[model samples]
Target: MTVPVADDWRPRLSPGLVLRHDRARETDVLLMPERIVVLHGQASTVLELCDGTRTVPDIVAVLAARFPRAPVGDDVGVFLERTRKEGWTR
Candidate 1:
């Protein structure tokens, strides 16, 4: 089987915000009352970074610099994987 690249499964983005919708988390699911408040910080930042110019690695790099306390390389990789699978990129 072929290996997957970090940006492999995600859709293409033109511009603007890309929202993350989670099925299990009612807060992240659209129309839910909580409305992603629990993930208001990092997760939102992750989603917003999916611009055309920034690859998955670039996104991680920028966030890493911005948030020294946050997990960078592997963490952003995982989050991007999930976001890609969930069709959040496009």
Candidate 2:
């Protein structure tokens, strides 16, 4: 079953999952058991903030500040929801 991400939700990487930079590939990666998911674009940035310390709005605020002209609120919401469904974030 899929759960909808709430504005107050504080998302974090699931157990046994780690985010890291792959210098060889010059890209970020999501490391999980027997799996290596290559992260692209703002994925790494979004995942990095999913440390369970900040709520969805808090994260969106930070990203919005960093990228003033971008639609961070909607983008972050969609991204978080997708990641949650993929079992990447909890």
Candidate 3:
């Protein structure tokens, strides 16, 4: 799959997948066909914003505002690329 560029890319979590937050374990997980992806904190935040309506840049902006101390764009971009490769987003 081609990695989506940040500008015109509107990302949505893959269909048939469910994001579950485990409070007791303090973890986030993605459930998909025969697969489970454990998500770290920043990954959870970024994926929550991938609602099919927001471009990558838009996501970066929101994250930037919410986390004024961290530079998150590059990390988000890398994560999105990995997700795209793994067929976790569209």
Candidate 4:
């Protein structure tokens, strides 16, 4: 069953998955078995905070502080939910 991502959910990279920066590409990539998901925009920033500690609100707060005018709450929430559904995060 698919579980909806909650506001209190603490996200982290799934097992066996690694996030790294590809020097040649100059961007962050999610490394998994036989697959490389290239990250874009603030994706790397968002994923870095997914250390299995901070809740969704905390993540939003951090981003909001960095980009005070941006709608980080909704953006972060949607991004997290999508990543969760994609099995990249837990």
Question: How far off is residue 17 in model 4, in Å?
Answer: 0.9
TM-score of each: 0.58, 0.92, 0.88, 0.92
Put down candidate 2 lDDT per residue, 1-90, tens digits, no spaces: 333468789999999999999999999999999999999888999999999999999999999999999888778888889898899999
lDDT of 3: 0.85
Please list all clashing residue pairs in model 3, or write none if there are none. none
Supply candidate 2's per-residue lDDT for 18: 92
What local lDDT score does residue 25 receive in model 1, on the 0 to 100 scale? 71
Ordering by lDDT? 2, 4, 3, 1
Candidate 1: tens digits of C-alpha lDDT, residues 1-90: 222455533334323333556667744421223333345447767766765567766777789999998667767777666655654454
**Which model, 1 or 4, shows the larger lDDT?**
4
Candidate order, TM-score descending:
2, 4, 3, 1
Worst 10 residues of 4 by lDDT: 1-10
TM-score of 1: 0.58
lDDT of 3 by residue, 1-90 (tens): 334476989989989988889776779988898887889868888989989999999998999999988768667787888888889998
Alpha-carbon deviation at 65 in model 4, angstroms: 0.5
Clashes in predicted model 2: 0
Candidate 1 lDDT (Cα, 0 to 1): 0.58
lDDT score, residue 35, model 2?
96
- Stretches of candidate 2 off by over 4 Å are 1-4
